[model samples]
Target: MKLVVRVKLLPTPLQAAALEATLHACNEAATWAASVAFENETRRPLELRKHTYAEIRERWGLGAQAAQHAIKKTCDAYTTLKANLRNGRYGRPSSRRHARASGKPVVFRPQAAQPYDDRMLSWQHQAHTVSIWTTAGRLKGVAFTGQAEQLEVLAAHRKGESDLLFRDGKWFLIATCEIPEGDLNTHPDGFLGVDLGIVNIAATSDGERHSGRRINRKREQDRKLRSKLQKKNTKSAKRRAKKHAGKEARRNKDINHKISRRIVAEAERTGRGIALETLTGIRERARLRKPQRTTLHSWPFAQLGSFIAYKAKKAGVPVVYVDPAYTSQECSQCHHTARGNRPSQAVFACRVCGFVDHADHNASHNIRQRGWMVWVCGAQSTAPELNLIA
Candidate 1:
């Protein structure tokens, strides 16, 4: 398993300026490479790689490894664009069009984020400092601070490369740490079903609910603030608004992290596998009304699910995804499926069997049952009421 740990970097003024210059030069070189790669009549890796890092190194005055990383980044961007076009994930090749488009000449923005390989980046565990190669030369003794646990991961399993990012006037090193995967605990007593939604972030089959009310309220507040700031049409107001937006995102991300941790911990403690609903392309298919579209799109269902999955993997807990079709409308008690089964957003009532429960909770139960059926009876099984051993 691979995870990224971000640590703050404290650099002297000189080091900071040099780092900024190096990032700018690297980005410029990358833009040049990307334009050349896309404008070429034949778009092959062999033709692209022919451009070479030595050319960028000589032109940009960058370290050999830094130059190589910059060219690789350009190639990666082009490759992704090509792949997306091939997979139909996107329409047409935008890079070619952009390269030929008339304007100020489209170029990659120098966002002050650069990738550093092992040769360009090194950490000093005892001194709590990092040495990174810069255009001016190698800058040593750039201090960094992080949590003890994060530092431990960096010291023990940090590998390959790390990203140097400049954000909000601060420098950060995002280290990728590779952790060993543990044997999954598959023979569980039961499954902990989780239904993810907009109003409630998650509802467990065990009757525990993690509400999204507060998160929704905060999002609304931020939206209104942004609107008012945009109306002002002032630079300072726009800057402040951007800052608030970032803060709101960080807060929501932290909440998701906490909620996922709790959910995974509960499954681990109870010796149960976690079951979640498959929600691929849910937003595109939802066909929500204009007013509700923003709210639905803002829900962090994907982020929450990913967090739960990675955390569960680290804990050796099995996580499964059940088909989401009719999970909300299907009755957990009576097995009746109908749109009218859920008369209200929060109420679930089965007309045939007179079984009633919280709408989300009922959906969670159905999800758990479906997961069991999928796992035990095989995915082809359509009997939702099949008997299973606990």
Candidate 2:
């Protein structure tokens, strides 16, 4: 599996200045290359380089490798933009959004991340330092720090290009690591069902509730603050908003990591496979009130599912995706399906057999049973009455 390990780079003032200058020169050269490509209708890196390479080297004072990377980066950006246009990401071709997006040449941010090949960057794992190429010159002994596990992975399995990015006045290097997966667990004892929801982010069949209350509260607070800042629209307010831009996302990602780690650990310990809902197109299918829309949209259910999957795979734990249709409305005990089974958001009461349980808990039980049926019988087993048969 391919994983990205990010480490913070701690550089001296001189090193930082050199890094900043390198990024600015590279991006400026890329911008000029993009303009040339746009005018000449050139999308291939080689063809675009034919037009801009010599000038980039002479004007930007970049080394041969850096010049090639900048040109390639510009071409990559255009390719991505073309793909987005084809996918209708900017809406229909007749729409103003599409027209505006398609009519302009792509521009690069001054401090946008630049990829570094092995020739351009060298790691000193034991010393926790790096020697990297910069526009001013080659920088040596630049320090970096990360978690112990990340450092271990970086030393043992890191490969491919590393991206140097400047964000919120901090420098970071994201290194790719190719970690080997463990042997697959062909025989699993059971399935650990995980039900995802807005209130409780994840509820497992083992009756563990990873609540999202705190997360939701914090998101709400951030939203309110953001609204106030936008209304004020002052320089200081904009600065504060920019500072808080990714705070919620970072916090959510951390929580998801912890939750996924625990879930995978428990399933591996008990020799159980992980079961998740196939929630594709959930955003379009879901309908909510005005205020609740933000909550639903902001929920990171997919992120949590992905985290569980990758961690499970690394540990040789099997994973299955089951149809989520009617899982919340169906009774886990009696297999009865009705709207009345779920009288409220949190409670599940079976009308047929008078069995009661937590709504999310019952849903997870249904998911677990469905996952088992799908695994053993080779059927979807999503219908409420499918489990009633011998």
Candidate 3:
């Protein structure tokens, strides 16, 4: 349950230069340290952090502790990435050749607002709350990552929280606060089921279907502007190019959050489980059709699933990811197997039983049934010798 809140780091022009400089120095230090570790032991020997920090400090003319933190940060990254690979949670670690991105590298945490890790980073919070990082015993600057107020704000808002600290160059303020959650078990009558779709974003088991059209006018306008910027020679193009990558991510995340909230609120009345497609090969299969590639990725199936999962958990409602097999093709009435049952985009009429229904509605029913089977019957379908979704 961790969310990054980005804020505007309102550093004065001079302060911005210094901050950026320090960050570059840190990144360079990390790169050098990584190089040293790899060269010293090509066999993946355990890293030794003892005096590397001291050595780096002497070479970079920074404080000794910064050097140590830098090397430690580099090692921690390599190790964590390695661990993630082992756990099947991430891809292979990056080679030095492919490394990119900005921001100062840290061992475990950033150095700015570093003292918060130490239980003391001076901060001011009267009205708009300021998170001040300390340097030479004076508070330095605040973080502006995104809705993320300075980490220090959390300390003031959440009393009895630990003071802030910076591990590498990152500031962190811990908050021990309790936000009210309305009683989740308040009602047990109303129930709603949802089915994620390809053309339509969602088709509820209850006849409500939501389309996945990008309807935010401002976002659409921004995208068009970005498209225009990407063509001609201008700084705005580069800036827009950079910002454009983030737009899709942010847009999809926000939309998923809203959609998940609506679905959760609908189901919370019954304390029931939400039904969702497992979404295994939706992308691959959908992409087999040229027009569907954009649609498939635009659906943000993973984010939608994740949003539903967390929201359902926080509420007393649970979510069920059914097998998603034949959800669209299987006849809801006679359990008939006929691809022709789904005659068109909006229609599903069973051939074997002569039953008729909207395609999305029939799919929704199958999803709900499969979810119930999984949740209540503890039924898991056997894996085939060769599994293919198409």
Candidate 4:
């Protein structure tokens, strides 16, 4: 598995200017490339083939080498970008597209080697900035010095591995690292029955339920903040809008991590496979619940499920995604369907056999049954309730 860790990059005063310039340049290149792609598609009727690199440079009034380099860094990867768009895609392709030119610019494609000028100025973080052709040697820098961790490459070549993401006015570099694959049955755990819900988040068949306190509190907090911001007309309010939204997102992420960790740890301790819902069409279904749509959608079911799955994979624990159909309405003990079994959000009482139970607990039992059926029937198990083994 590849794990990406974002290390803080602290650049010197001069270095910061250069970094910002480079980022702008890259963004411009991306924007230009998008425009070029659209033009290429439009020009197809004129029997024009893709523009050559030389033609692109002259048309864009960019330096031969620089323009070529930008194309390499930007355009070639987005297959859907040019093709999916007609005339232009709805939103601004980028804030930097140039529409004044004709014909088409060459599509950008990254070469295996880093394309930049040598003798460019860069100061690596406390380490020597060494440049060599194609492949260069690097002595790894010291880790975690409390100071901002930064590396400046003056036209240096890299191993073609780093992925950069620009979002919310910041750039994140994802460096891939390999992790060893281990035995699936390396450690054994007992079974865990799970129940999924929008209101409560989820509950274990063992009577342990987790609250959706994070989302509830977030909505209330956002409501108050939005109300306050709406009343103001100043920079502080704008700053608050940006800052609070980011804070809210981070807070939500932290909560998800905690929830995932809890579930995974519980499964590990019990040494059992986890039973979760196959939340297919959940997003669509959430939309149908108009009144409580916010609450239903706010639940990070996908994130939690992902965490559980990956953790289970690493720890050799099995995970079963049981079918969620009728989990709440069907009686767990008798498998009898009734309108009165789950008459309300919290209450679950079976009308057919009078099996009174917590709604979540009843659903969890069915989830477990689904898993058992899978283990017994292998690939033939369609959902959470195969009965041959039980």
Best by lDDT: 2
Tens-place lDDT digits, model 2, residues 89-156:
89999999999998988899999999999999999999999999998889999999988988998899
Predicted candidate 4, C-alpha RMSD: 9.3
Per-residue lDDT of model 4, residues 1-390, tens digit only: 333334333334444344445445444554565565566553331222245455545544444444555465544434444553434543344423423222244443321222344232122434533221111112133122221322222112122244333345443343333333335643334457777666667788778887776667767678678778978958989887876665655665677667767876787777677878887777764434565676667656676676666656556667777778888888988899776787887889988888888898888888888876765555221222110000
Candidate 2: 10-residue stretch with minimal lDDT: 381-390
lDDT of 2: 0.88
* RMSD (Å) of each candidate, 1 decimal: 5.8, 5.9, 8.0, 9.3
Query: What TM-scores do the predictions have?
Result: 0.90, 0.91, 0.70, 0.69
Model 3, global lDDT = 0.57
Point out where model 1 deviates above 4 Å: 41-46, 86-106, 377-390
User: Candidate 2 vs candidate 3: which has greater lDDT?
Assistant: 2
Which residue pairs collide, candidate 2?
none
lDDT tens digits, residue span 244-361, model 3:
6666667767777788778887787656667777777776554246655645665577777776765665566656677777778898778886788877878999888898988888
lDDT score, candidate 4? 0.55
In model 2, where do residues sit more than 4 Å from their true spots? 376-390
Best candidate (score: TM-score)? 2
| Cα deviation of 62, candidate 2, in Å | 1.9
Q: Which portions of model 3 miss their true places by more than 4 Å?
A: 41-46, 60-69, 79-191, 214-228, 231-236, 239-245, 377-390
Q: What's the distance in Å from true for residue 337, model 1?
A: 0.2
